[model samples]
Target: MKFSKRTKLNIILLWVFTALPMSIFLYYYYPSQPIDWSIFMLMVLLAIATTAIPIYIGNVTIFFSQWVTVAAFLAYGAGVEMILVQLSILPMIFRVLFLQDLPYRLIFSSWMFIMVSFLSASAAHIAGYQIGSMDTIQILLGATIFMFVSLLSNHVILYSRERILGQKEKFFSRDALWDYAAGLVTLPFAVALYVLQLTMGWLAFPLLGIPFLLITYVMRMYNTAERANIALAKASAFGHELADRLSVEQIVNMFLEHLKNLLPADNIYIIDNLKGNYVVMRALEDGHEMRIDVPSDTIKNSFIHYYFTYSEKQCYVKSSEWVHEAPDFLKNDMNSLLIVPVHRNKKTEGLIILTARKKYAFEKFQLDIVHLLATYFAVSLEKAKYVNAAVEKSETCALTGLHNYRFLNKTLEIEQNRLNSNPHLILSALMLDIDHFKQINDRYGHHAGNIVLKDFAKLIQKNVPEDAVVARYGGEEFVIILPQYTKEEATKIGEKVRQTVEIHPFLVDSDLTKNRLDEIIYITVSIGVSSAPEDTDETMSLLRNADRALYIGAKQAGRNKVAEYLK
Candidate 1:
């Protein structure tokens, strides 16, 4: 949990206010009786052990150390009990602040524990708890007051902190109920320890400590298994969703979105390896998407190169361990990192780098989840690649490598719909035919004619606007669709293509029987242009008008000329 600067300052002020009173109270009520060093040490150790194995319920952790604190309070006085409880809070602080990478939790948790301890101890003292007395009624009364005050104060502090931080957490929840129930359940154990200690002496500690430790261990294992099951269920659902996506861009976007939900990260980078050079394909930083273009040599000197060369997954808990090899973009405010290589058929396809602003931010379970997602991502990407290839094959001309007639028809239909929706939009079409093409085959063989056709396709493609769709219309004929061009503009482009083709030399071998390489041949083309809503409102009429102009205005007027359909 990160907090705003104002929230952090408010929490620090709250801690100061609570700690000051607690210090003064402890000073005034310092234990007057001589302390038993052995018993004190035993209680401290037991408190530490119990605090370490807490039961997690949602965002709240329930520690059994309260039993130890109550027992210490009954045997020694409030002064000793407060010290013991405060010392026991160290392990929890370490776990929440460092292990969990929650910086704001350090101040909030410390103040919360102090407030709970002081209020509960005050309640027990007010209830007439006489230290070293074995009266069962006083014992039960003091213990009940202690536990009740502790539970209530714990929630009160939690609710207060949340309110102060301007968070919308409910005051009452199922987890809160669990906290109260857990407190009730642990009360008897504290009573038993206090009563049995007078009878069994040192034997009482083991009798209670062993079973407490055992139960804590069992609950910890159950929590781990439950979390694993939940994570696996999410991963299975994510994999199914990825399978439904049909493009690489969609898969990458979905992968990053799902990953952000499943894990905590400050920055996520998807680096693609194309022909042995790493390129940053997509990057998500602080909830925004961007692209980072770094020099190849700069990337080579970073940890991305290390992962490619080694082909092993890596998780660094602290930036200091790997800072020297980090790229420039990742050098600031990034502490933890998990890098997983996306593999397809035993070869590394790309790399996924997840980074955080705090140390030890990623756990082992999160690493496992990332590996599973990477596998799913690779498989989906491969499927989309093959599907795209198949679609490209169906729409491309095999000989000329240009859009085939089928694709041309589909494009014209799509453009016609667009023109119908927007009357102001312009669309133009060009029909082109090779002049005396049969003579090329008769004089220079069919193979030479095929070479000339391929060259002619390349020439038209090069001479047209990039957005223009050039297609092989049929044998010795080609079509071009200019989406935003008028009749005048289309005629200009048609003239350009006709002039280039007339002057260009087609290189082909005149004979296949002899190995003579270079034979120069020249060809000319006749072109006609038509615009939608000017010559006709429909797609078929647009092509028809262009063809009519090609034959009448260009072919009949003499080949190697450009003409537009006259309305």
Candidate 2:
């Protein structure tokens, strides 16, 4: 990694502060007194075994061999403790030079150990901690203080280097907690070693390797459990997010996005076959999209059909088999696939296909989570379909079989936004009303009136321009929204409706006999035309202006006349 100028300067300052004092201390306090060759060799052997397997917990590397240093401190004083700790750094340095590890990291690790060793030794001395006379309480207290000082110094240096390098990890994070826990875990071992050395002398050193391996195994299991808990937390969060979605499209999008975050794949396809037709929503890792429309019959005859028929609810196909069994369209450049069938009412509703470029990209845990998500997605799909059907029914006008006022409100709001963007685009609103509609109801009964209204709506729809929106605004008042039409063009269209209604013979069913009337009744309509951005740009304003013009120019003047807003 390349360091910025600021980071380089910070690393330089860290080396100066920690390495300078540590160099001076090591030089002045070097074990100059006559050394015991036998004990020295034993200490060296202990140091090698302790630092052999450096447990990597997040960004920090920990040696479970701190018990050896603590044991040496209690047995042979500060000189032997410092010498044993320094000996551990030599193996790490050799690994960096010959095993091609980063020299900067190893060098920093040496400095951290040296600084931590000085503080821990001083803490042990202040606590009156000596070899044979120390009780269990003194040993525990000294070990705790020694561990705390080492951890604190290392945390400070780690955070300083990370901050300078623009790293986004917290100082007192999971790794620091694990380091503290490791210290606590090694305390009993350290105490045992100290006691054994006092009694058995140099013979006790070889037994350290057994406890060190057991600590390594226990720490590995702890790390695995931590990762599993994290995955479960994410799955729970995603489940809540999926539950809150109101539409099938929204739920599908959220599921796809959440799945990508959990396990990244090169290509993903969600095949929803429950809607009578098959819709394949495909997304590439690079963010390109492909929406495939496959006939349901094709799916029924393909390998997917066979799987749904014979296989269990969840399916996993290896790359070698998937390539041969998958359909031609799905076989395009995909290596591995995971297919999970969404279940509802004890039957499969749809299938989710996860594809990646590499082989064996998915794990058992990810498949389990995908199965859980698919259940929610199936429920969301059913709810969305029911809601959409109800909304469609509510927006329909029962008498004329056209859009009601509620639907008109939504359409007008959309049109007004469009008019705002394209100021030059012509939009015309025609307010049409049957002439003497109340007289027709009273003369021939409501059944005849209903017939007349339905026929009139049909006539208006048939005569209006293509792409025009027609809706029943209320009883006997209909609205025609003509897009891309001027006031003159709309007036001509309005004239066509007025002429057609005036000439066509409207059939009114007999009320008493429940049969068609022999004589056809003729009716006319009064139309008021208003163009958007010409008369008014607002939907409500345009509507009010058209209604006003209809009353003044059509109804007041006489019915069966087409009138445009004067102003």
Candidate 3:
């Protein structure tokens, strides 16, 4: 197998920039340095430190191990310092292998470290730090120079690579400065350790451990805080998404999708309290999802039953054995379970139950995060309920529960625009009126007339296709909007409505004050059909044409028939 042209060039450049210097350094200086035991230990220590855990601050990463590198350089001469630099490449080797880089790239990376280490040694020598000397000020100067050289070399390489690759990002911006700042923090401490070693002998080595451990602990704490901030940010983003959803099912599904990714479990169940029963709208078992309903009473009596009762604390069961009273279905193929209640207005609206195949699957911090997410779900659920209620009230008629005049006009306008965009598409409109509705009201009662109108709305809803919209236009009148229907198809639908209403019996109570019905009466409706691009393109024109047709068919034609608009 042959390498790509780019890869070949990279390999050649790596050898020129790194391997050449390494060969020269070894030939000129390797024989003179006799491997001092103490210096070798320092070299090994520096290598280990460089490879250990790295602390990320903002956009920059600080490797606390570099402190050991500086100490090795200050205590030993340029030759030992150079060897320490070459050995420090061990960590980079591991990283390159972990990333699965080519073998050539790993060799290049090791050489890159060697070259940087040589430059750092040259800077230290220029700062007047001699081999094995105990000069405190010179040690400090060399340490400072070493840090600056290492930082500059790394940034230069990064900037050059990005420029060659045609990247848009500026490599030498404020973020670079942050990286320099991170290294600066460790420099002073590394120099301090060298100073202590000179004054206190071998005892000073333990002194380095004290501050190293302290700094390590501080970085760990910072990491914990950073993770918490990220979790909160994720929860806040999900909350905004949940608020945009209009239905309880939509909100619950969205919340569950995000929750599954954030927390892994063998099984997850979202049980909603609908009509006083716990119905599982979504259930996941070993990654497969299904919907099932668990009886509310059965769920309440289970070992995880505490979730039904409102409480701030989450019920975390680490082992199934502890839950001896758990339901048979729940206990089957489960080792651990966690139950959290979603509360709204101090009432438990629902429960989020998680099960794991292994015991003690969830940690304390994970449970805390789950509780936080559940709270977010609860708040969003309540908000969606109110939003849906307000929308329903605005769109529906209060008396008949059908789409009102406002919705009718809005729908007609929308359908008109759709028809305008597609000239070939058809939109059919119908104007319907009950025959002798006023006479019925005067003879029977206005309340009886209302019952007939409501029954008429229900009949229209049942007779029309699901895609058609039936709306109450005004008193004793209604409109039906059907998309993709020609005048011939709409006339057929209108005829069906007329026949159904003509034959059906409408029950009414003879006594106005009583709720029970005692009488049955027959009724009929006349319908006018008008279609878009066939009758008229305009919405108001279509409505007027249909109304005129209704007048001709119902009034002039002696009522109870379907009429089509004549051009």
Candidate 4:
């Protein structure tokens, strides 16, 4: 209903171009005979009826009104034919106005129909078409020229419009071919209808109208079934892709990517509820991923909360249906919306929101497809969570929550291979031991020793660089693997660890004292450092040298100290 300044200008220009020439032509070429009002009204009705139901081929909609127009032209003249053609476009314009956001299409379609009718009629008149004279060869020749010009002019206008709009589309496509073929096939029917009208009078309408309506109905059914089949196939393939993903992030990305292919959307949002707190996991605007932080109050005020709380899937064909309840985050010039709650075992886990800039942008079938995709996402997320937990249990130390010996060995091999590939790179290893660890267990209890070990792992993790790999080697011993560290750097890190551990307090239960109060005791660690190519090239040998230095260099000389491999 509201048009921008540019659209108003285009509509004015289009109307002038269409109406001005048409008025001048009609004034100059007025029919000499008096018009038959009843017959003309009947022809108008037939044309309007045909325009109401169109057969779709790909992106093109083929209307059967061409035959009715041809019959009208033959019975009357080009002037009347042009008028009827313009009037017939009203149904399609109304359809678009109510169902889409493309108001410019109203004037554009009018302009296209006016030009096509005028130009094609002029061609037929030039080819010796005359009202009230029905000769077989001349009629055929004139109708053929008219149909050919009509099809060609339509494509020319369409291609020009597409090019002006910056679209890369060829003038002739399979849809165009279908249009031409349909026109040719209906030419004879037009002639037959005109001939039948001369004999059957008004009864000739149903003779042709009934069969055309039937064909349109059948084609509509077929197109619906075909679309449903294609959607199912695409959904199945998308489910397979989701199943192959191994992480929640991967699944979210894949869902967004495929959902865009399934429908036209201007924005997408993935909102997850983690322990009763709503968080925006992912967002995409205009097909590009974006980071957005929405306040909790805004989400609570929006329709997302309603959907999540009720576990309902909703589709809004117009903004008015939801604008009253929408928060600031949902008021982004969007008109249509589809929100589906992600459910797992009858509990809502998250919500998926898709929005478009046009009315009726999302259909019912698309909503169904999104529901199926949500199910697929929930299943894949559960599978990935369990798979990651299983993998972590295999590679992690249960007591200290650090990498176990198995992971340590695997990491060493990987670091050694990386060092071998780059001559300039260096790998460092640190072997650390808690000095007199058994004495604490004997004095207090083994439970106290376990607490010390856990606390020591936390301290080591806090001191090391994030990229460094720290693992519980065995007992009170631990290993650290540092990539790209020299021997001197590793020794400096080892000294830092030794100093921190010697001054740190370890909390333990006073079992031998038989007191309710827990006691804090001091502990010390001996550390040894070794580097690749400086100590030995092999990974295990580097570890062995660091271990030898920990016992012989540090443990033998002092209780708590840093030592480097002698070799």
Candidate 5:
């Protein structure tokens, strides 16, 4: 495929910035100049430095991260000093080209300040070299002009940068090359204009400094782009590797740890949704170490309220604006924060906030990545919930609504899993039988018997605790898995079930005649209750005992009563 016009233009611009100016700077400085070796070295240094101007102008003002900016500036400055000492203003070339022949104001300010600095040094060493009055006035006038131009340049540079450069952005090779050319081509011209102004009188033109500024801008673009690429590649590789190796909880923690490496924030917090309450899993303040805490219920409630109110967009509260935005909870303490709403299947799940010591510490891209990771976490959590639900379902019976035979085994599994935390707790299993249910089906049609079973089941359901698990064992029999209850407690539940079923008339009238369909009837049920084994090894014996008690209750004299199984 053919490249687009923009891509072609960028390619052309890169070659020009990278190759053309370096060739020209080389032609002037080689072979014959005094201290040619030193001059060429300085030229090389300046050429390298010129390419960093774009990044400096774009990123420095907003992030206020002076360390890297200063590093790049120094590198550029030293390179210019070695490669093209006299002609260090390489931004002028691009200022004439890309900027529509209009000069960037930074060029004028930067040059003017240097000129003033030189003049100040000269004036300090003047030793009262009294010039004529006219010359003195001319010198003062020139100084004033330079200072005013420099101040204007400063303002223009700031405004231009803020409007032109976006937040948390990365640059590419094509853009970087443009910056390199701008800085390289303009360095000579910028120096000439400054030196010429000092040598030649009122005839000098300051606008000539703009082309050099443009070159500076281009150089910065290159350096910034290069750094961004390196950072992204490293983050991607590390994140992928870490994600693969770590467990789910560790991955969550690593994600929290990695946010600081990519973005700037004063504080980072991870609040997990634990039963409708926010549990602060981790907190980062400044660049210091992180702290983990299980906060109070009140604190969790505060977080829930905060999230419910502002879980859509992001909440950024400045120190000055804190009183207005979060007067109650923030209470004038928060500086600035980014609040992102985490979602799953269009439902709000939780909220995340990354705060900055300064105002507006977050960018859309940073927030996007952060939220993207959050989405992954949301999906993982959703999967975990489904798994837990499935596990719970497997432990109980689906039909007859009572647990199946496997339930006794699962009860032991849970008890083992509980780690003996609560020894005071007791569990019981109650097996119930519809007395002579099969014989009734033989005598009174099975349809009538089915009604009896369902009616008796309803009575048992009403009498048992909400926590009780009641399910049909098979035809004519059922079971109840009762937790935190002893034999006496199980007896109470069983006895109540027996009495309710024996008295509650299932049918209003009997069908002693030939198959009367409108017959109302009553039924009796027998329940056998057994306690859980105190020792883990005795679980099987406990279940067998419970089953035997059920048979005993069936054989007992009373038609509707409860029986306890003793070891």
Candidate 6:
């Protein structure tokens, strides 16, 4: 998706607003005194926090903001002894939130660019302010030292993160965190240089602490970045393992398993449907055990309503969100659950309901992982549904979506092949045809004839016995094979089908393509039924006899009627 021109313009405007104020504040908003060392650390922490806020804004998750705030606040106490200025954490923030898992040198280069940009703007602003009438060189040089340390510390942290993940890049090529702790390394050297310059009576001695502070900031940022990457790697690895085992059950169990990980006292289950009856599939009360299927829709729907209603927020499965008959296993065992519907192709297919055994047993990250797993579950379920539909299609008629001739043939063979040996097994078949079907096609049109055929199919379907096989044989002709049926039973069913089609009207178009829906027309059919005899051998012979009886019924009754072949 392309961002609109207006949206692109607005984002640029917002970036300028944050960057300009930060630059101006760093340049001119200091106290009028020579130095306040205590507040230096505080101001550095504040600067880093301001920088990190944007990074957090980009990541935009509750957990992301929380962890970033904690890490950036901790980075303030780094390298302040060596560098007179406080350590800045802006670069680490960018690496963690924007350019993730990159080389240390690349991270440092990006940080160097950011720091130089900020320092240059701040230096210019400070010169514009005319503070104490000092030359511009004094402020620029001081900002330059801070900029170097900030860049170094940013590199160290980025390297540390890469090292924890067992990855080596150009900057993170070293195995040890100490090698990349440039912020800490530069701190001692900068302090020593500043001391040497001060003892030798140089004018720049007092500002060398900025370099020391820069180095320590780099050291701390590297440490924090490395630790976060380690934790993130572990979290990701665990997720992969869970997903590898993910089924309809494992996917749901994973969410319920993490209630203790979230807060505590959380349980979860899936009911089969969201809007219909309750079909519970999996439940977790004691440990991470799971079955093959999820719960019923009745229980699942309660969670679905909750999920759709509270999509904006992470939800817990509460008693209020569920129905009265939640589940015998889940009822009274837990109080609340967070419902996450497993959706595929934009519609909910299953539900992931996590219950809170205690208050807020699940945190935000738990919900995130569950949502991810839902996608995988949906894919698996879709495969299962497709396999079932394919199996059904193999046996069904392509035109009418009913049992095809192949299945009917197989059914007749099975019934007769056994009946010949048993001598007691009875079988019957009805050969039926639409009366004057060709005349109707000529009178109305082939299109009307098609409607008549489809309706005729439905008519036979409604009248046939549950065990009977009804199939289209050819144009306007059909066959009904009934196993374990005597001649009398077959004749009764033939009559039922004969009457159903005789009364049921079908829409047929007129000669001029007029509306068929308005016109009503009736069609009749003749049926010939024949039962298996103890001496009967060939199935085709029985079919021939029934077909002959059908011709006789049509000629004698002169209307819709059924004729049975006598034994």
In TM-score terms, which candidate is top?
4
Q: lDDT at 6 for candidate 6?
A: 61
Model 5 ranges off by over 4 Å: 1-331, 346-351, 354-365, 385-396, 400-408, 416-425, 439-458, 465-471, 507-519, 534-537, 553-559
RMSD after CA superposition, every candidate = 5.0, 9.2, 8.1, 4.9, 17.8, 20.0
Q: Give the worst 10-residue stretch by lDDT in candidate 6.
A: 55-64
Candidate 3, 162-253: lDDT as tens digits: 67666767766887887888788889877876677667755666667555766676776777577667767887787777778889888877
Pairs with steric clashes in candidate 4: none
Using lDDT as the measure, what is the rank order of every candidate, best first? Answer: 1, 4, 3, 2, 6, 5
Residue pairs in clash, model 3:
none
User: How close is every model to the real structure, measured as TM-score?
Assistant: 0.77, 0.60, 0.65, 0.79, 0.45, 0.39
> Higher lDDT: candidate 2 or 3?
3
The list of candidate 6 runs beyond 4 A from truth reads: 1-269, 272-329, 333-341, 346-348, 352-377, 387-403, 410-427, 465-468, 500-507, 512-522, 532-545, 548-561
Say which prediction, candidate 2 or candidate 3, comes out ahead on TM-score: 3
TM-score of 6: 0.39
Model 1, poorest ten-residue lDDT window? 95-104
Model 4 spans > 4 angstroms off: 1-67, 70-85, 94-109, 122-133, 174-203, 302-304, 405-446, 465-469, 477-495, 510-520, 526-567
Which has the greatest lDDT?
A: 1
Better of 2 and 5 by TM-score: 2
lDDT of 5 at 185: 40
Per-residue alpha-carbon lDDT of model 1 for 1-567, expressed as tens digits? 457788778777887887767756753664424577776787788889988887766556788888888887777766677678778987776544333326556666766766776788778878887777789999999899989998899888888767876888778888888888888888998888878877887778888888988988898879867876787899989999999999888999999999887777888999888887878889999779987998777778887897887778888888788878888877466788999999987988788999987667777787888989999999999999999899889999999999998899899889989989999999999999999999988877888889999999999999999999999998899999999998999999998998899899999887654665668989999998999888899988999999999999999998889988887
Please provide, for model 5 over 1-567, each residue's C-alpha lDDT reduced to its tens digit, 9 standing for 90 to 100. 234556456545544564345434433432122233443343334443443343433233211111111211122321222224224334433222312112323233343333333332234224332211125444344333323332344334444444554433333333434443433443344334334444553233323324444644655566556655655565666555554532456556666677777666656776666566555566676655565555446554454456644566565545554344432333243466676767767856566667765444554555656666666666655665676567657755554444555665666568544435665667787877887777677666766676676666677788899988776677887777787787898889888888887778776222344656566556677777787654222445555666678777554656576878855
How many residue-pair clashes does candidate 3 contain? 0
| Better by lDDT, candidate 5 or 2 | 2
